[model samples]
Target chain A: QQPVQSPQAVILREGEDAVINCSSSKALYSVHWYRQKHGEAPVFLMILLKGGEQKGHEKISASFNEKKQQSSLYLTASQLSYSGTYFCGTEGRGGADGLTFGKGTHLIIQP
Target chain B: NAGVTQTPKFRILKIGQSMTLQCTQDMNHNYMYWYRQDPGMGLKLIYYSVGAGITDKGEVPNGYNVSRSTTEDFPLRLELAAPSQTSVYFCASSGGLAGRNEQYFGPGTRLTVT
Candidate 1:
């Protein structure tokens, strides 16, 4: 099943902080975060494996809670360049080689 | 490396027509995938290949077919174009190794069927 992302959309000011959460009903083997700008392909951010520690990219980091089957992307000191749609993808035992992604969280960082 | 590249960045097909979406990666990755994204919707996998000779269906594999005869190429074939097939198609590749599942995506192919 596809994961669910909270706060379908969010607006943030430069230097602000924002959190995008993704939750799944099934147990997760791994969680991946990606960012997509308008008309562009999604770019990989980080991947958190089950029982793995948190991973970060620049000012953005992510956490995976195995017990809750959830993951959250943290964008700190958000920059205007961060304006884009962020997606969280999940893969579990039954998913095999495919990844099911959440609808996505639209983040707008305005000047 | 070119990462991943897809041919025919845009196409419009008439109902019942057939076409192929070509995808190629220069990174020599072991895993390749095809995904379609409707407007404002998350991507849904169409098909994937774990290696040159292995292919598998994904969530939305209907109305589509794929072949992976070589490591550098994975092409998606649309047998009979339908309106429902209109969407942006993306091709991605990954190393499929430990801590290397991060997929590198192509720009994407936008297809419209009417």
Candidate 2:
């Protein structure tokens, strides 16, 4: 099944903050995040492994809560370049190859 | 170096044509996947491979077939294509099922069927 993402769409002013959440019913071994611009391929953001393994790039960070089988992407001090669709891909016990992606959160930043 | 590469960035097929979407990765990754994206449906897994000689069916693999003959190549074949299959297809790869490895993606193939 497809994961659930909150805040289907969000608009923010420059320097503001926004959060995108991805939740799944199955237990996850890792959570993968990606950003996709209009008519472009999705770019890898950061991956959060189980057991408090945290990873981040620039001001974008993600945390995977093993207990809840959920992950959240935190965008701090948003930039215009952050205007895109964010998707979280979940990999679980069956193996990572069978990834189920969320619908994606459309984030728009205004300068 | 190209992490992952896909061919024919855009394609338009008739109702009953066959085509193969090719994908290659230079990173020597063993895991490869094919996904389809519709307007607001995000991405649906079509097929995936664990290694050169092993392939598995994903959620939406009815009209698609995939092969992993070599570690560097995984191609998706569409036989007797239909308009319902028209969507943006993406090819991606990851190292393995270890840790939190991210999957590298190639520029998607936008296919339109009429």
For every model in order, the fraction of real contacts preserved is: 0.48, 0.69
Clashes of each: 0, 0
lDDT of 1 by residue, B1-114 (tens): 789999999999999999999999999898899999998889998998889999988889999999999999999999989999999999999887313378889999999999
How many angstroms is residue A7 displaced in model 2 relative to the true structure, after the best TM-score fit? 0.3
Which pairs clash inside model 1?
Answer: none
iRMSD computed for candidate 2: 2.0
> Which pairs of residues have clashing backbones in candidate 2?
none
> lDDT tens digits, residues A39-76, model 1?
99999898888878545465568888999998888889
TM accuracy, model 1: 0.96
Instruction: State which candidate has the highest TM-score.
Output: 1
lDDT of each: 0.88, 0.87
Candidate 1 wrongly placed segments (more than 4 Å): A54-58, A92-96, B97-100
Question: Which lDDT tens digits does candidate 2 get at residues B7-112?
Answer: 9999999999999999999999988889999998788888988899999888899989988999999999999999999999999888876236777889999999
List the DockQ of the predictions in order. 0.56, 0.67
Off by over 4 Å in 2: A56-58
Task: Write candidate 2's Cα lDDT for A35-60 as tens digits.
Answer: 99999988888888777776657667
